[model samples]
Target: MAAFGQRKAQRLARADASRKGGLDERAAPVVQLLNGRARFCTTSSCSGRLVLAQGSAADANSWEVQKKNCTWLMVTHETCTKDDVMTALEKATGDVVLKFEPFVLHVLCQELQDAQLLAVRSTHCLEVPLSHKGKLMVSEEYIEFLIHVANRKMEENTRRIDRFYKCLEVALKTAISANNSPSQETENRSVYIHRRKRKTIQEQDVHTSLKDHNEELEPEDDTESNLAIFAEIMI
Candidate 1:
């Protein structure tokens, strides 16, 4: 489809521009499987990774710009240790955060029906939390799935980092194992559109559908206070 092609092109270009090797190695197999399908294409992805960062502040406001303004104590594609986090915290002057992100991805589905189907299955089956951020731009004409591990945080940077590291390990295993089946892959590729093939989707209907997807992927909002006094470990 033209819409799918254009979005895919933009994603590929963005990946090509990345200095961190673009796509993460661990995410390649699942990305290939989804992209190879006619009904789905990945828009963006990160195969679970960790970050040790220092920022000016540690509040919800700071989190919005954390990535842009933060100082990287260390970043790893693999797991790290408490000592690793501690060492980094020693150099931490401002709010220090050790973020462990699970394998997360944004997928574009060809149809609203298909999006619903994928979303349902992804949550009930794949087990990773999926957020539907509808119609970001003209390019996000298709439905989008923002999949990620449960983001964990603590005010005690060191303690929270320890918990996050363990959480990341568990989430990574969940993501990898969830994709390890031939039957599961087959099901993911299956098309779900039916009955409304002729029904015209109106502009107003688009907003409604987006709302449904948001409800379908309900996630808790956790925006708390600043974090300080930390050590970071990098592996």
Candidate 2:
């Protein structure tokens, strides 16, 4: 446990080692929230992005475009326009691909249980081959369509990020509440029971008042003639 804490501290100290040299604005809050907890820390994350890159046609098996050999014509974290795509296409010399990368996050948890609390998943990014050997494979209209699709994907990515943040916030709060000391837990339980009893009493009072009101509305039969019949029956 001590070793893990030490390693986590060391890694977090240098967490901002990405090309941007900082955490992405959209992902910063979530990263901070996780890192604030004792059992979890974020290793890396990207809120989502659109990228136009030039890569070799022969490297079809590669999972990612090699940064060393590939050229990044354009990169944006926000939705882009068709003109942006065209401008980026002009710089492509090899196989070019336009990509809409969705929200991704990597978290390191101290225990498997801690990791299991996070169930959010991101959609796989979309990749469209735009150019082959400096020749545009698709028409301008098609590029516009691709841009529209990417923009829509970006909007969905933002929504997912928001949801993930909300769910994680709730899960972390529940975990923390569960870890409270015995005395605190008892106090909380007592408060809850007290509130519940108060509510029940209030409801009962309302019911009694309503019943009384209804009884008052009923016609009262105050006939002395019925008293004589009752006495005769008793006799």
Candidate 3:
């Protein structure tokens, strides 16, 4: 009876220990990866929190989640801001903000594959299960480099646009001024021509009057000479 009782007691202790182990697993950290969806990194047994900042240090292990020293990402979103990215990462996960450039984004996949070679060459540390994002094979150096390059290209594009708009404004203003000035000049020229035309018509009327007066005086002189001839005959 004593032996049977001891065996049952031992079994109960083992069951208690197993339960404790399960709880410990639950206490472990949890990492969330965003890829058009929010997915937890660990299985049912693991639960905690950690944050990894891209191009910077990892956050506190208040809830311990593993973070890689080398991981690359090519984040593409039109409406997503830097703040939005940080907010998504607030719950102890990596935040890699990759600004998109069509010119660079096209070639980035190949460059990331090359960078993976360097990452594999690094000293072997304990493998922290990475919450894979997409099909882009990338390393930490590649991600950091790409982010900076993309941001620089964005700045250059903004400057180019500003210069283009300034030139357009200047051209439009010049065209408008030319059009308005010519209109005023044309009106002045029309008024001058109208006055000249009026003066020419008045001069032609004056010449006609002088010609008629000379014709009438010639006829009167001929009549006076006829009378003088008649008077001499009488004498």
Candidate 4:
């Protein structure tokens, strides 16, 4: 566990450096592997989707560059609440958790965004029983996967917000169109003059013709657009 902490500290430093645009391709994988969670299954060989950490972001973030790196790592956190982690060992069902390499635990948690929206079903942190084989060595690949999952979730949220805006915007446009009806009023460039109904047959005919002409320029109904308006900007 001492070794895991040391390596995790190293990865955090690396990630912090990377966040600051210090891109070292080789160093990156090492950081992620040593500091990230690898999915595991207790009952079956095939693990579920997510391999989120057992405790906090720090726990989830640190992973082993090689299995040897975290072999000595152990769980020490006493406060494992379900809100941010999974600590079934202590009767705590925290979602965000990290499994020490020695223990295999099953835990249910909500995605970082919404617990209700997504059921992150991956093993919390499977401490590979020395007997349990099959990729006992944590790989940097899982780190990449974690990043992808986070990005996809963020994009989904952005799209949802965009759809909401589009729906609202379309409604607003419809309302405006209804109120200042284009048909009844004339276009500014080609002004429409609303006149009283004339008693004379010729005058009435002219008035009727003008109304018909104005109706033609009423413009297409500002209504539903099938495509989502991704950029809803109100200026």
Whose lDDT is higher: candidate 2's or candidate 3's? 2
lDDT tens digits, residues 12-122, model 1?
556454437577766666667667666667777666555655666535243332467867766766655555544655565655444655556678877774465444212
- Score every model by TM-score: 0.46, 0.72, 0.25, 0.19
lDDT of each: 0.49, 0.82, 0.36, 0.31
Indicate the TM-score of model 2.
0.72
Return whichever of 1 and 2 wins on lDDT: 2
In terms of lDDT, the best-performing candidate is 2
Tens-digit lDDT track for model 2 on 130-178?
8887889999999999999999999988888888889889988988878
- The 10 consecutive residues of candidate 3 with the worst lDDT sum are 31-40
Find the 10 residues in a row with the least total lDDT in model 4.
40-49
Top TM-score hit: 2
The runs of at least 3 residues in candidate 1 whose Cα sits more than 4 Å from the true structure, single-residue gaps closed, are: 13-15, 58-65, 120-235
Which is the better candidate, 3 or 4, if ranked by lDDT?
3
> What digit string (tens of lDDT, one per residue) describes model 4 on residues 1-235?
4554554444344433211244233223322321243221111111111223322222333433232222222222122223222222233222222332211122222122222222323222332221112122233455334444444443443344344336534654564466488764544313312111112345457668979878543442335211211121110
Candidate 2 lDDT at 166 equals: 92
Candidate 4 accuracy as TM-score: 0.19
lDDT value, candidate 4, whole model: 0.31
